[model samples]
Target: MKIRSDILRIYQSLHTWVGISAGLLLFIGFFAGALTMFKQPLDHWVSPPAPVPAMLREQEINSLAQQALAQHPAARKGFIMHLGEHENTVATMSWTAGKPGRELDFSGKQWMANLDQEGKLQAKEELPSILAQMIDMLHRTGGIPGKIGDEYLGGYLMGVAGILYFLALVSGLILLLPTLAKDFFALRPGKNRKRFWLDAHNIIGITSLPYHIVISITVIVFAFHDQFYDSLAEVVYKNQAMFGAPPPAAAKPYAAKDMLPLTSIISKVKAEAGDSRISEIQFFGLESPRPMARVALVNPRYLVQGPEAGYLIVHPYTGVIINASMLPGKESTWSAIVGPFFSLHFGSYGGDMMRWVYFAFGLSGAFLFYSGNLLWLEKRRKVQRPNQPLPVQTLSTRLMAAGTVGVCLGTVAGVCFTLVAGKLFAAAAENINFVYLFVYYSVFLSALAWSYLLGAARASVDLLWLCVLAALAIPCSSVIMALQSPSSNNLTGPGIELVAIAMALTFIYAARKTGKRIRDETKDSVWSLQQIQ
Candidate 1:
């Protein structure tokens, strides 16, 4: 019992340090991740509606393929038909600029032939909005770029952080075990501010323990997936042949114009795939001889593994099925295992409802981290005695307090500015990615600077108001667009505006409460506005 008590005390200290250490980065990951839940809708909100009157039907695709192939004979090298769902490349055929995903990050060198309003075939490349992509990049890489232009370095750091997070969770639960029955849901909001913050933190953490565990494990798994796959190949599945040979290049030359129609292939795949929504058609080995295409689909209901190709390989020349992995069909053990890993992490299985729920939980998690930092600061705060100058706040304590204000409210400002840029830029602006980088970091760094310069109490109230104003940009931009052209559908704009208003109101309330605490509190603590200067 004595050994156990000693271990418990050690773990208590460990939890405090570990939680503080990982809290800020995890806050960024969680906040960005929550926004990523509605990534598709938010991306759609930023994306322009499909222009050019006529849709890219199967008949017109021949012209598109011919035009693309003629312009770049390498279309046969590596090609794909982006049918609507793929971002920024709707009604387009993409040819390899580099080695596709391996050498290049995103779809490289895409060309789409669409009929103009005057009935002319116009070929152009499309670019994606920076707002949604920035959020996703922040979530995955923690905004940390990796070398090889391929690896995700932020994922590695976040993975390490996730492991520490799991440890902190375990240690926290252990420390709280003795008081479990008596103070399980306690929220003592009296004179002891530390008690109130600790109670709130504990309640939130304990209630969401399982969820936190799932997120941690999933993040870890995703971060090291490549290593796991390599291990599986070398050890458990060494003797087995998991996949078949790559489809051979065309055995005979074929004109791009003679490519088989798309509707029949889609119809056949559809009939076989149950209700899977056909998303992509990848054309392979046009450079070789035997050109083949794979039709990929999206499973809307009951399929947790949305990442599965759910595709069928067919000869585009003969319209004959080469290899069939049709929907509602059996999959290999590898895919069965790997599919759900990505699906659960990405929340791609469930539709909007699930995404929204995940979004709420994500925000709650960010709040949990912010609250944890405040609790730590409150616990260690130093007060003054007689007429002596106020005790200097420890550098670490001041830094943490500043970080909480700077990172949290600054992220709010950064995101709003990015969204405003996305909304206002009608034509694809030059250096928009650089613009995103500038806006976000400027706000974030400035907040940190101001936090230390002005001290915690003053900074908190001022930054929170800044947060409110920045958040207001979302709705204001939407309202301006609405007023300019009232006919636009504006589906995501209103919902996003409503949420922004609510968050602004939240900041207002927080600023007021923080102000009150600053004025009313007597202790010469970090939150107190009493004489320190």
Candidate 2:
């Protein structure tokens, strides 16, 4: 297992630099991504009570839909019918008349409908919470904001980071190979802080290497899949359509009432999908000549096309299956090849237990990056001899320490603050989503500036305290809401609050440890108040 000294040194340099370059961004992405595992619960916790009744029978759902379609022309375009299965189900049926833009665009009017006590259709427009979407965006983009043309700017930056991450993984593994047998599971925790950190980092990285590799590869693909496809079209397909032409439109448009019953559609989908459970039925172009219904089914036993579920599209009028390529046990060859990647990245299989595992892995991944940066800083630290003057830490080391503290802790505090803000402003704010973005950036940027101004040691303690308060606010907000409207709370609300409470306690412990380190650690290093002075 011995390797050349020169090769080991080369890999060590490569692993260090590449990991430093990608570490902070990946930290944010992984931390936020972990939170996204329970996005439905967070969404439900922040959302207000449904404007329309949530409970509705099949016949009532039909009545509500038909009445809304007749009264509101926008409902004819497309709408999602909630089967009351998910925690975030706001209404029996809802539709959005948004600006003709990307599907993820939030600039739109949403309408929800359900049957009232008198069996009359009750419909209203409401603002949906964007807290979960914000977290998902962070996971996708690594907190790099803004857009480049039609795409996210963060996506392009993260694509480059993903490449570096892959390189770092390779070089790190190469470096670890020489001592793999002797020190694979060894963790020496003592006065040699550098050795301790390195041991912990290596252990986590090596154990989770497969998970990291999948994330690195999939991130690159997800970020730049459009460019990849465009290149394929020009080079491989000679500018031809990759999947061939889509089907032609029908001869005439159909009325909403002409569509098959909800029960009939669900039955057909179940018959086609076997034991997969239906969550929602999303109708697209219901008034158009070529209308389709996408039935979202969740079956943790198999890989899913999307993060939460797999889907099959069918003709809304005839109940004939349109596209079953994404359905489990019925995927096309290409889809079968690509589906597992999505399933693995999204943790879409193995039910809630798998989701919890992914959550733990995500947090561990974040810690891996954070500890990597700490190791980098420690490697560059200047230790003073007993008879010599105090050594000054390098500017690069100081800056890296500050940046790591700022970016990592800032993201944590920012997300916690945003959650608290969402609950506080849900009732009063006209656009709670805007409030979320504003609060997040304000706290995030402020934390970053504070880190640079006060240095990592001081800023770490301060921001950790801020994180504790922000996390504590979450459960307190829920408790207040429960007291004000006892009936408005749901099971998911308490679950989210309990997690927040645990997070608050963790931050409290972190703050105390950071304060202790600042006070007792060596003055020659960047992680001490004397260094800043």
Error of 2 at 487 (Å): 4.7
| Tens digits of per-residue lDDT for model 2, 310-372 | 889888889888788889877778788888999989998998899889998999999999999
Model 1 misplaced stretches (Cα beyond 4 Å): 1-4, 48-57, 60-63, 72-99, 102-110, 115-120, 146-149, 181-184, 239-260, 288-294, 305-329, 382-392, 426-428, 486-493, 522-524, 530-533
**Per-prediction TM-score:** 0.84, 0.93
Clashing pairs in 1: 76-287, 249-290, 250-289, 250-290, 251-289, 251-290
lDDT of model 1 at residue 314? Answer: 77
Q: What lDDT score belongs to each candidate, Candidate 1 first?
A: 0.71, 0.85
User: What would the per-residue lDDT of candidate 1 be over residues 464-504, giving only the tens digit for each residue?
Assistant: 99988888887887777667667764444467788889999
TM-score of candidate 2 against the unseen true structure:
0.93
| Position 497, candidate 2: lDDT | 81
